[model samples]
Target: MIKEANTTFPIHPLIKSRWSPRVFADTPVSDEAIYTLFEAARWAASSMNEQPWRFIYAKRESDAYKIILKHLAEFNQQWVKNAPVIILTAYKEKFNSGKENFHALHDLGLAMGNLSLQAQSMGLAVHHMAGLDWKKLQEIFNVQEGFHITTAVAVGYYGGDPSVLPEDLEESERAPRKRLPLNTLACEGKWIEQ
Candidate 1:
């Protein structure tokens, strides 16, 4: 099942092929390729096109990459260090005018989604990691104020044998995916429960 997503997911070739991998092979992700993915994300829809999303990325061996690597918790670093690149997704609330700009993060999500899909289309693996260190991320990159770091993703080719992954992870990888019964989450006319 490790490779099953390539055939599923609502996204076209872009998203259907992406998945989170804890291990990435030792290889270089070219700068131009990353730019192409970001370009696709740059075109995603935004609130009034405020374009709240911002991405800070680092290639595997650069000093900037080291900064990103430091922001990850010990657990994530163990597996992610080998990734060809790590991209941090952020959203700026200063662009909005209200007490609540909930849509800022939503917009960032859309951008990241677009980025991930684009990466997949290029035959790359992108893994979203939420167990990020906020303080380290904010401090290390010197990100401008008001932009909250939402997620960090490890991108590259997957490495390590599935057999070597911890038991639970291995089993989870092998299991068929289960989704909610559509009726439970979606409603027909009147917008009421069935």
Candidate 2:
């Protein structure tokens, strides 16, 4: 089930092997593994050492898990139910100096990147979703001001019956992975519209 990226240039094996899956096995991710993933995120580079990222996670069997599922958009709820773990991501909107931290979300993304790669290394699958009711989550969690909810993530071991998904999603699950060419993404010292 390894959907390794077909890259033009060689890349790290973990990066190549990582792909988000809508289906996840029923196996429970170990607490140790979860801690390890966060440990990796904890070391990611942040602006001015203001590691603004915050996470609220729940195991599938927990009541909190149900609450999170309820807040997700209908489409995400369809597939995320099978995940062993659900995580809510957020970032502080302001620095300790009371100034806006424009890079808060960017730093949060770096942290999630670290977590995702760590999950891949551990033989787990991670899928990030932006389709959720963030305002509800904020209210539910009583997240104080200056912190903004960003996204939700599903984590678990891979291998589930794609056939169980709706026809369209099943097709998407089985589709070949594709990416834009590097030339279109990066150029020398100038912006080029492709």
What RMSD does each model have against the real structure?
A: 3.1, 0.9
Give TM-scores for every candidate, taking all chains together and pairing residue i with residue i. Answer: 0.83, 0.97
Clashing pairs in 2: none
| lDDT tens digits, residue span 1-194, model 1 | 25544333364644444567766666678889989989989999998788998888888778988877877887787767757888988888865564556688888888888888887777778888888887678887787778888888888865545565567766664566565665666676657455
- In model 1, residue pairs whose N, Cα or C atoms come closer than 3 Å (at least 3 residues apart or on different chains), thus clashing, are none
Model 2 segments more than 4 A misplaced:
none
lDDT, candidate 2, residue 49?
94
Estimate, for each residue in 122-172, the C-alpha lDDT of model 2 and write its tens digit. 889999999999999999999998899999999999887788889998898
